[model samples]
Target: MAECTEESTMCDPRHALLLQSVQSGLPLVHRPYAELGQRIGMSETEVIGLLSEWVAAGIIKRIGVVVRHRSLGYDANAMVVWDVPDGRIGDVGRRMSAFDFVTLCYRRPRQGDAWPYNLFCMIHGKDRANVLAQIELLAASCDLTDVPRDVLFSRRCFKQRGARYAARALAAS
Candidate 1:
């Protein structure tokens, strides 16, 4: 896999445009990208090509939606952090990611004395207690009894979307 860098050539004009469109997300319309392309002075085919190229060049990671789970009746969401041994981190992370209940899982950099967890997982449920129980079951199944973890429940959401690329156009101009 190509490593992410700030000065990568993949951050070209088309890539920038694709980033802007992705950050804005698909509009709630029958032809969202086509409409978006019209607004941005490009055809839908061109936009799709840009996205495909960006993905090929590893400039963009993944494109997907961020559903408003709470509004959709999913009231519970928790960030579960685990401190797995260095050798087992990959194994544990893969296992967690394979679980349907585990929506997101990755190894984040460990904070100093405050936080030592490296493996992080996000779980969603209908309620807080249900989510907690699910986490406990997951831990047990993974034979992670000795693993130290903490559950951070979200209380509020401010903004959730991809990055904007309008600034790139402005900079070019």
Candidate 2:
């Protein structure tokens, strides 16, 4: 494979336009990429192919549907926090993010003595049983059996809304 260079990513004018096309977001259609292609003057295949290449090159970290769970019948969500070592945090974080049940996973800067946990994952479900089972499975699968951790379930969901990259997203359900 050819090396992905700084110039290819940063200096390309088409790349900038392409990024902008989706910055606000692709049209809320059945085929978002096809709509994007039509607007950007590229074939749907070309658009998808380029995106696939970008993902392979790690230019795009991930493509995911960000659902506002509380609005979608998920009543309980646990913010599972881990006090993992700095050296192993990256490995642990990646492993934690791999779980399908882990809806959101990221790291936070440790707040010294007040807060010791660095890595965090959000697991949302209708009840605690399913969420707890997922946590157990995650711990075992990721070799996090004895890691220092805490599970904080949400008492209330004060804010529940999907991310607004575009002005609208179609919802037929």
Candidate 3:
């Protein structure tokens, strides 16, 4: 096994190749790594090591799947935004993130005039009403009654993929 240095972790050829392959999200078969390794001039173990190292170094934020909610019967998904005080945004975000039903929670730059929300969360459920109920519960739990909020349900999805940076890197290479 090659000793992975900090520099090697960032832009090594093997790591780059593994990143490109993972970003593509092609179906992983019985010998997925081995097949990928063959194309990238590495063995399966080497590919695994490169990925593991990248993860440890925070180069790879996550390895996961993106499911189409509508196809899976979870048709109702909403982007719930809150106009939380700057001081309490972190506390509110932490509380929101603690909920299993809250899939994504983060702070975003407030859009002037139309959008006043600074904190955002994503809630998914079987129906729009169910999703609203979940958001209501979340708001009550976070003592967010005084805060203004809006829920934006996605009407259409243009594109969804993992690791946009990885895709750009592959394109560059």
Candidate 4:
């Protein structure tokens, strides 16, 4: 990969346009990269090369889809927070993340008496009862039966989209 610098990422006009096109999400079609290149006056190879360079240089952290679970028939979305022991959080988190039902799992710092939970995981299901059952299974599998935790279910759906770095840059220009 070629050396990546601040100027390489930001000074290139083509890169700027490419970033803007990607911000809204890649086109839903075969050969999306090629399509994006055509739109930005680049070849498919050039588009891939720049994106790869950005990822390798840490300019781009991740390239992934933001799934709308509700549209996929997953209506019961719950975030389960656990007050795991500090020393065992790593192991516990790994175990929790291994379950297929658990869509997301990570750790956070506890606040105070009002909020003592640290570990967190998101579980999406077709219904509340299914989600609750999966949580129970998770507790048993991770040996977190005695752990203090809470399940906060979603009351409403929110719009989900990718970051708009290029859009903001264009607005500022």
Q: Rank the candidates by lDDT, best first.
A: 4, 3, 1, 2
Clashes per candidate (backbone, < 3 Å): 0, 0, 0, 0
lDDT (C-alpha) at residue 27 in model 4: 90
For all candidates in order, the CA lDDT equals: 0.78, 0.76, 0.80, 0.86
Residue-by-residue lDDT tens digits, candidate 4, 119-148 = 999998999998999999988988899999
TM-score of each: 0.80, 0.59, 0.84, 0.75
Off by over 4 Å in 1: 1-9, 53-65, 165-173
Error in Å for residue 94 of model 1: 0.4
Residue 32 in model 1: shift from native, Å? 3.1
Q: For residues 24-128, what per-residue lDDT tens digits would candidate 3 score against the true structure?
A: 774578987788888878898987787787789887777677687778987788989999999999999999999998999989999887888999898878888
What TM-score does candidate 3 reach?
Answer: 0.84
Cα lDDT tens digits, model 2, 65-151, are 766678788978899998888898899889888877888889899898788899899998998998999999988887788988899
Better of 2 and 3 by lDDT: 3
The positional error of residue 131 in candidate 1, measured at the CA in angstroms, is 1.1
Q: Which stretches of candidate 4 lie over 4 Å from their true place?
A: 1-17, 28-31, 38-41, 53-66, 165-173
Whole-structure CA lDDT of model 1: 0.78
Best model per lDDT: 4
